[model samples]
Target: MRFQLLGPLSIAEGEDAVVLKPSKPSSLLAALLIHPGSVVSTGYLLRALWDEDQPATARAALQSCVLRLRRLFTKYGVTGSLIEAVPGGYRMNADADTLDLVRFRTLVRAADGAADAESELYRLKEALTLWQGPLLANVPSPMLHRDEVPGLTEERLRALERACDIELALGRCRQVLVDVWEAARRHPGRERFSEQLIEALYRTGRQSEALSEYRSVKGRLEEELGIDPGPGLQRLELAILRGDDLGPAAVDQAVPLPGRAPLALAEGPARPALAAAPAPADTPAAALPSAPASVPPVPLPVLPARLPVPPVPSFTGRAAERAAINASLTARDPGAATVVVLSGAPGIGKTALALQTAHDCQEGFPGGVFILAMTRPDGSSVTPAEAMADLPAPGTAAGRILLVLDDVTGADQVRPLLPAAAGGAAVVTSRRGLAGLVATHGGTVHRLSTLEPEESLELLAATLGPARVNAEPAAARELARICGHFPLSLRIAAARLLTRPGLRIDDCVAWLAEDLPARLSLADDPRMSVPHVFGGALHRLEPRWQEAFRRLGDQLGEHEGLLLSSGTLGGSAEAEEALERLADAGLLEEGPPGPYRIHQLLKIYARRHAREWNRSRTATAPH
Candidate 1:
């Protein structure tokens, strides 16, 4: 199937054009087609469809639109393999040949490296012909407001400029002067179009008029962009004023000014910075053009800003923690980045809290939020240096900025990524306490623990509203209790209840009250169950700590009481250190000179790990 979005939205299979219903689904499908092979989150889609006045049934309505689009593909005899859902959103997988905009760019790149001026002019005009009218002329999509649209709009203008360059080379400058002047008037802030107008005026023997045009554009640039003109246009103005030479290279040098990139464009309030042009895949003997003499010194440095991933809507509680994180990261300082590490157990909401805080504090950072997942999906670690290489350099952009390092295992993993600039801040979430990160960066560390009983119940209510939970107060309390006030387990239980409509709180309570071994195998959730969420922390324990945790679990289960002293830890210093390590990791709660109690579910996980470790050691022991 071929999708045409360069003009009106249309999809065709073979030679037959599929008629799409003129409604939100058609517009929504058009929006998704803008960026092929990329995830467009549900949040963005909703905003696009509704602007600010979203309906209550927006999620369901959006899903219906996607379903209808897929059905339309099936109806047209094309397999519905084009669009699919990702974890957070949906993505379309269209290629360059099938998409008009992509084909246009390919043709432009071919013209950029053509051998002769005639062929270059031909290719440029061919590419320009693809645009029938203003982009997506008949499609009423909210997508026109997106950031990528300006870059898409640049394609036509660039093809026009390249054609003008070839025309000037063919001694047709006199024929293009009127068009160039009109284009320059329409887009006064664009340095290239204005430069073309100046060249045409100079070629027509209006040297003084060309100089006057350059002076006017220069003043506009200073007032609007807070910067001077680029080297290319400035040099052209000088050459015109002095009547440099009517040489062969005169056309090629029209827009190339020293100290700036040849393809640089003037940035306005709505426009992003223009990147240097890419070299052609297959180039001729003559190089296309030299890169910038150096990085173009714009008044404001370009920042590779990215949106922070948001948590699910059910996120609740942690009011104090959120306030603390916001206050620290948003503090007014002109020295070094304020580092705040959220140390907690696995599945204890550390990453979620940090992400939510980053979203909340986004307004404080003009450079925008930069989020890095410290661990890969397969569970391997990413070195700090590798992560640092992906972010903007320290002290490069303006205003406050945030760098969120999620699921960190060690301080050393994020050391290189830490900024030395004062206006920068980082929120690092880790199971292990990053004391060294705080010490080196002069920041604070907050140890995150499980929610309090009221807070845990509130989290459950946030997931399954108060109406349902209030109807079964006893069952709700019982369910929360069995989950040990653990945020991860409560969320999982809520999910089960959400999926099963008739299932009540008592059903969840019965599910949670089952024996540990039997329940672990029977739980419907593989991702957020008690053992799955809490078990990984056990394996992270060192040998001595593992033994202590296992023995402690055994004693707690056997009614040996909650408090442990030197006697229960086998009088071993290694065991004592291991117990403290477990406490610091949020697997155990620390107390003064006694046994540290753990959550009821955590005790079970510890006991399981302890028994497994002992069994392995015993099996390996000499017979």
Candidate 2:
């Protein structure tokens, strides 16, 4: 029996083929087969099966679907039990002989290790052929299609790129024209394919066509992405226009394949010849062409412009905040630079929002989007001078640049790093309100608060899947509320539930409510703990401010919405200062007028600390 996942979901034995009926079973089978021989977690399978609208009895329904898949396999004469029920989920047993995906990967690996160009090209073409159409085209699972299909498609395209490169190297430019042309057309934004298509056209004696292809791609990029072609594509066009030697040296210099070594082409006048290969490791240095001063030094390759920010796959909400930041970053005003400060409490998704905004507004900043960590991993602050060293030198990149100063400890730390050029932009994210930075630099300070109820639910659905969340809508909402609607806390809660597939939403809520801010941590990742995040913020406060925070927490217990007047903290001028300080640190939210309120989770955390402080004070008394 053979499982086919390179295209649509199907099983075949010899000439007989069968596609599992019903979308749920097909989705289940695809999920299991994707990770053959490994357990597909029950939580993942549930999400794949139902997406957002899971029934209450999803677990039982999942079991029924698995049983149906097994029976279908048996009805089609698939030998043995291909599907195995593991402890937490199901696993499909398959190998290169039984699965098309596995076979495709095997061929690609073989190509990677091939000694000759012909052998490598053959294996790559074979692997490419296995991709009949869009991956799992008939599989009706939005979760699978969204997450799994794109990566698989990317693998096929990379393999195709490698095969076409080899064909060009072997002086078979005419043969590769069709594949390269189709690929460039299909994926216009992918510059690598466009680069290859141009080279193939130029080598085929169609220089005008090659130049025209470059113009088309340039126009498309400017129209869609609002950016010019990358340095490599521009260089390739220049080389063609100069009518320079479009040899292996020029071609390789113009467009280098990532993760691929320079190809050694067959010797021919029409075909561009590769530079001389280095002598074998065993050869004596005296036999080489190097004689110290006589040997020309190799120039360092220029690195591409890229933002170091991590990908936020499950980022959700803050639509208004995102729009505000986008406008501030992308606003074109040559007279004034843009500096947007995102200030909020720890774990409120400050960095996530900043990075997402950077990615969204990347087109406006053509020079590059650079992210500098203003705080080190150990919680020490990064000095302004040290942070400035990470950015491009003054007036280097042609276009305007955007710098992201993340986790800033003070306004002073970011002052030196701010872009001096007009039209430049920077985004600063920190726990403290950095009002001084905004006051000095004249930028917008977006003080983030907890996410709205619907936004929090949307975040939970994105991470935990809509099926499980929608199954117990009330419990899910309560869970979000218990998490204080903070992005970090909600994410931690979602992680806990995801790791424990059998834990019910209401039961998890009960467990969290019993010992929140503490139970809100994942044991594996200490970074994901709410207590750790809150503790860090508390640690940053002075002793007096810390005491004020604890006392406020103790006094505000069980009544989260009760606004606190200055009288609650002795009604003195000093008391008002303390409240303002706490609010600035994001430990308190200043309500209408002079009163303030604390988040429910923060209140619980603060109360826990306040009791500890009181007990210690009693024990240390002279009595």
Global lDDT scores for all candidate models? 0.66, 0.75
Residue 367 lDDT in model 1? 74
- Best-fitting candidate, scored by TM-score: 2
Pairs that collide in candidate 1 are: 231-257, 232-257, 335-422, 336-422, 564-595
Candidate 1 lDDT score at position 157: 77
Global Cα RMSD, each model:
21.4, 18.4
Off by over 4 Å in 2: 1-303, 307-311, 420-422, 591-593, 617-623
* Best candidate according to lDDT: 2
Error of 1 at 18 (Å): 39
